[model samples]
Target: MMRRKSWQKNLKIAVAALLIIYAVEHILTMNVYLRKPMLFSPLFRVYNQSGSEPHCPSVRLSTRVLPQIALASYPGSGNTWVRHLLQQMTGIATGSIYNDEQLRHNGFPGESLSNGSVVAVKTHNHYAGKDYARAILLIRNPYESMLSLFKLANSNHTGEPSVDRYGKQWGTFTEERIRGYIPLFASWIKLQDVLPIFYDALKQNLTRELVRIKAFLGQSGIKGDVRCALRDSEGHFHRKETGITLEFFYSKKQRMAVNSVIDQMQKMFKDRFENIREDMDTWKL
Candidate 1:
């Protein structure tokens, strides 16, 4: 009789503790539902207020369809940043063919290479799903882009910089990245299947570039709230302040090195180079 009483007391205590936890969690969830109404209200309504089917799922109608355009960029050219902007502005996610673990850690959604509902897909690979109408090629001057990439390779080395066929070392890694991409850029530009977007434009005037991105993606209704985008992106870990700047990255030696590489590519891809002829110097850099 004494043991039975003790067991009953312990069971009651456990039940009370569980009830307290459930109540606290309910309150917190309600707070979130109130604060972020756009994100949570609809789902909450479906689950809480639906008559017979309290567990009915919220139906989401996609605003855009995919097999969509690629937001293509070489590494360190702010590819992940632009993808975040799109995700925030539209609530549609960005994807990559490679499904890099690094990209996901930065808040990208799951692997979405074939997800047609995705708004924009990131790709560094040349020939992945070329049937997309056009690509938003995010270009940063190689001086900054390569330098940023080199710094990344050193601090948190990934296979990104070492993927060259010839096994180029860090001294020549930047040059090889530029040389390899010049021909690819020329070909894509010549085919007119790419809209070249300079990374500087996005940084300097976010709203203007946001408008361009919306126009390119054919979704101008969402306003592309630049202030909101900036606020939201401020907390992401991958976006740590790097102290890298355009003026800092710009150097005569870097310019001359890239120019030599571009010159070599230009000889072989003459007609193709004509596509972005005006921006070639910046591209050369």
Candidate 2:
């Protein structure tokens, strides 16, 4: 009985020892895997060919040989049209448009590209408080933007549900539906209320808007014809062959109110132009 009891005790100790060893081995393996660098393989290939590791500053400089301008605007504000025009003016290919995939690979903010001599990014997000170093804010008639948005919502080609169905499903039914047709419409409804407030602030100070843009670009030591860079003279406001038609559904008073709001926003930006220029001059590259 004593011998059998001793054997049982020894068996339990051995099992525990085996389990501890297995756990330790598993942890070490996982740790090594986690430590492996993500871009190491690509970096190694470049270094092997060049006989030196490329520095990040050099990469940034190369990407910024020409200023990297982002086309910042609200949705339905002719962003796509502006992108195409810029591509033509700069002689960059459409296939080389900066996007999130290239941005991630190049470590650029907001999935922008680095292939063009002058890189321009486009986005609709609000300015990064004061963190952005370069940006261009594009303003359009708010009424037109809303009209375009409504048409886009009503269409099926853009992979959105019909506006009539969208409105009913989401609540707040109008004779027309414009909900699922636009991306993230539910969230946008909340934003729409606040947009007029910000728009008024912006319109009241256009000069400030320009100055803020210049300051952001100046941080990269990029100084050029800022006016020409922002010009949209190519008459490429609409997509080619998309057959999208915009119809105004708002009453005259409502339309006028929208225009009035936009006008105020534009005027605000205009008033702050000098201040913006002064701010740009002070930013360090």
Best by lDDT: 1
lDDT of 2: 0.41
Predicted model with the maximum TM-score: 1
lDDT of 2 by residue, 1-285 (tens): 999999999999999999999997887566546542121122223222357532312112233355444456666566554444334333332222335452234323323443335545665654443323344555455545555555454652133445565343323322132222222222222221111112222334422333444454456564423233223223323433434432224555454444455444444544544332222111111
Q: How close is candidate 1 to the true structure, as a TM-score?
A: 0.58
TM-score of each: 0.58, 0.39
Report the lDDT tens digits of candidate 1 across residue range 1-285.
999999999999999999999997998677646542122222232222345333221112244555456777777777777777777655666667775776665566544554565666777666443556667888776666676677576554233233342233654776577666665555455445556676766665565566667676664233334334543543253434545454554457656777776565446445543444334455553
Taken over the whole model, the C-alpha lDDT of each candidate is: 0.59, 0.41
Error of 2 at 237 (Å): 8.5
Pairs in clash, predicted candidate 1: none
Q: What range of 10 consecutive residues in model 1 has the weakest lDDT sum?
A: 52-61
Model 2 ranges off by over 4 Å: 1-68, 93-118, 153-248, 274-285
Cα error, candidate 2, residue 277 (Å): 18
